[model samples]
Target: MRDWLIQLRKERKLTQQQIAEGAHIDRAYYAQIESGTRNPSMAVASQIASFLNINTFLFFPEHLSEPFTTALRNSPIIVAHCDLELRYTWMFNPHPDFNTDVIIGKRDDELDHNEGTIGLMKIKRKVIETKKPIRQYVSFPLSDGLITYDVFAQPIYNDGNQLIGVATVSTELLT
Candidate 1:
């Protein structure tokens, strides 16, 4: 049984039915969650956490560690997460000329207002709207020169299953 979940529900004076309704799920499903007979998806967990006034991360295991960091550090591909507004939220192994400081919280247009950045933004917007993944070759004009990359972008969701933004992996294509 999920003792912690049960304890929290009791403390709030909420029954399984109430939580299920609040989370837009069936009571039996919620009951299964409480009984530990079923595992909740990220979206369901987020809803339950919201009802309990807690962070959704509580439902997930903390597995990100040194290995993850090390791999990302050594990776050649650039990885980034952006908000719905297309502003960068997190990035790893960015281009040689650009650092985290220049990327985070900034949109592509903010970094470089050109045809290339415009095209990139359009691709990201399409992914966000369609809730799908897209892969294309994109070019960016930098101070050094124009660099082309194979970019893959997909919709990113919050724990609530809400589409929050897009995550991207970009690898420079050598001629």
Candidate 2:
């Protein structure tokens, strides 16, 4: 079942009929979607998501395919998602100095207060504000030395095309 959808609906005190009316869909169809029995098309998903004030991507399957995830696991690349506030939401293949436990729910500035961390935060903020993708280099100081990474950041949006967060992919540059 789409537990998240149910939870959101309950939280908003909205019934399936209410949601269906708002999205201009049939109540039964909405029920099927909530029960995970029927997948909605992109247009239908967008309408429902807009009415529900959530991201349309939530109705889709996994964002990354299995093959891509498998390759990413063995690659020396970092992938991360952050909320609009720049707090880390999810991450994979973090640098040696940091782990998921240390990063999740924390902003870059919270983890380290240096020029590099500050720069990274600025870049993320720009993406959120401009709703655009960016590619740049960022560096961080560690016990060993300074590490540079080629970073790409993109703004994530909800069904209404509202900026919600940022997603980043970074590769450590070997000197």
- List TM-scores for all candidates, in order: 0.60, 0.61
TM-score of 2: 0.61
Clashes of each: 0, 0
For candidate 1, what is the lDDT?
0.79
Across 1-175, the per-residue lDDT of candidate 2 in tens digits comes to 8776776677568999999999999999999999999999999999997676555666764666788778877576998888888977567777778865466557898888988899889999999878889999998897769988899999987569877789999998998
Off by over 4 Å in 2: 1-65
Cα lDDT computed for each candidate against the true fold: 0.79, 0.82
Candidate that scores best on lDDT: 2
In model 1, which runs have C-alpha deviations exceeding 4 angstroms? 1-64
